[model samples]
Target: MTANNELFILSASHTREKLKQLRRTHQFFCPQCKEELQLRIGEIVVPHFAHKKDSNCPQLFSDGESKEHLIGKQQLYCFFENKGLTVQLEPFIKNLSQRPDLLVTTKNEQYAIEFQCSNIPIEVVQARTKGYLNASIVPIWLLKTPNFKQQKPTRIQLVQISPFRQQFITRHPQHGSTLLTYNPTTAKFIYFSHLLFIHGYRFIAKVQQLPIAHQYFPFLHLKEPTKEEFTHYWRFHLHIRQRFLRQRFYLSRKGVQDLLLKGCYGARMRLDQLPLFIGLPVRNAQYIDVYIAEWQATLLFFLQDCQISILQVDDEVIAIFILNNPDYFQDERGKDAILHYILLLKKLGVRSIHSSTKEAIILQLLHSEFLAKCYEN
Candidate 1:
């Protein structure tokens, strides 16, 4: 929030001459708390306001703020207001019990924009987002220090992802779920879509950048990956798997790596021999408890124990794996991923998929010429 108490609410830019005309007798107050503001104009600084010494507004609390953040908020206010839309600056929503840095309303739509500059706990972030969503107001968070890099990078500098940052992710109708961030200084938004977790918290994403002024949907999916692009991606994950043996990724507890490696070694499984099936880029793999190599190796050992091959893969067997590997996936997503891989293997004539729905593409593909060769072979 700006300290421009002398200026009007929602419109903070007032010339010193204009504010000087109001004299020392001008009446102003905090927008949220309504505490009286004292107008102070100086020869050096721009005309602004200072809350009276006795004022105690709960909203005044701040970990800290930056000049860029202040200017960005002002620029955004002007950006929306210039569009002839109804906009308010630092307005407190009574019902939601939160004050967004800026709020914009267009007849049928209301949006709360938080110019997020500092990192906060995930719980606090999710709570705020949930509150706004429950109140039927869309919350949009704009990150000031976002990671932007080149070449569909596997990872940016996200040492840790705050809960607030995780809320940036959302799914689309086609391509996949994506994460969004904005750079207020550049007036641009970044879209990180089609995410695939490779190892630990790192991911390979299709990144796109566009100006905030563009009249387009931010969540629109991008094009599918070319065969060569996909091949390169799988190879990248293979490298990540190799790195897992060297202990290069995040595993919460100490000596857990020893348990995972020793468990696989005792099964007479060579980590290098594991197939891509082990670390295949299922979108929900991010929810798995272990990194790629650990879980994938376990799946391979389980398959070997059952004496199963691609031709004999059974859905029941997959369910058994889920039952046995309680730490594999977060929730029902593990089941969905199992089904996806099973369906893919069935299409390749290496396994059989028994989806009972006629409208399902997997079932239809099974009956097509693609699966006919599988049956013949």
Candidate 2:
């Protein structure tokens, strides 16, 4: 048979019927034991065929098909009805761009029910639920299992939103709905609702709100730097410097090395190794700019063919170093150092920076104002 014909046979509902008829009519031989087998149905689990004796049965059959997905629109409608909630199945919701599984409206309150069975991307689900909330509709996520049964609806477990912060909060607590858990064994459902304070109103489902004092300058757990780690860090520092320099100037290996050595021992030392200068706060913008300017100039002196661009956004001066020669700093340290610099610059209100290669440009921009504006809206 062709491939399509085989698939059709495998998916046909009659496959299970045929197996049931065969079991009743014939005394089939045990595939493993080669002895006469007795047929048993609905013996161990839900509707299935099994052997009488626990012999070594090598062959396996599942009605020759995959189980049909049970958590469809109709199933969702029946589920809510079983909960004594009035539901309108397949309600049109424009924000979702698809019909909700069930639209429940009761006593001047309304909610959209979305039953999701498969493991989907978390961000996608968050975005969809956020959109629903923005449209003044509450979204109820009915997370079903692969084997969705009305008698044993799968319960929703409370997952930690921010494990690092030791915080647990439901996704959309303001919607006047709670996370409901369904017990398959006992056929019971439980609801959970709790309030949590989060810094930003971005549509994060499980947000762990750290202490407000550590909001901007979170204490980083530091360990003594190993030689290998220091080498990697220095290499990253060098790569970012070289990339920026190549954007403004052209330099030979000898020239680059000389410049790096000069900056390492000179002004770059004060800013790059901030922990050493304990009396002077590294958080100051002037202090940060001093280091940035020194590093930028060092790159310009070494790489003569590169261009460095700086943009002032808000209280921050963003720097972009474009490198013509890309292979100079292709290690992890170089990438990490550049990213660290961007984050530091952002914290200090020096806006953003872009480090560019021939292929792509890495951008580090702050979104505090943008986030604040989003909440205001």
Runs in model 1 deviating more than 4 A are: 1-27, 38-50, 58-64, 147-164, 213-232, 245-270, 310-316, 326-332, 351-377
Candidate 1 weakest ten by summed lDDT: 368-377
Instruction: Encode model 2's per-residue lDDT on 248-333: one tens digit a residue.
Output: 33443554465444544443442233221111111111212223434433433333223322222221222233242243333323
Per-residue lDDT of 18 in model 2: 68
Clashes of each: 1, 21
lDDT of 1 by residue, 97-159 (tens): 798888888888789888877777778878989988998888877776465453344432223
**CA lDDT scores, all candidates in order:** 0.59, 0.36
Cα distance off (Å), candidate 2, residue 37: 41
lDDT, residue 224, candidate 2: 26
RMSD per prediction, one decimal? 8.0, 18.0
TM-score of each: 0.70, 0.27
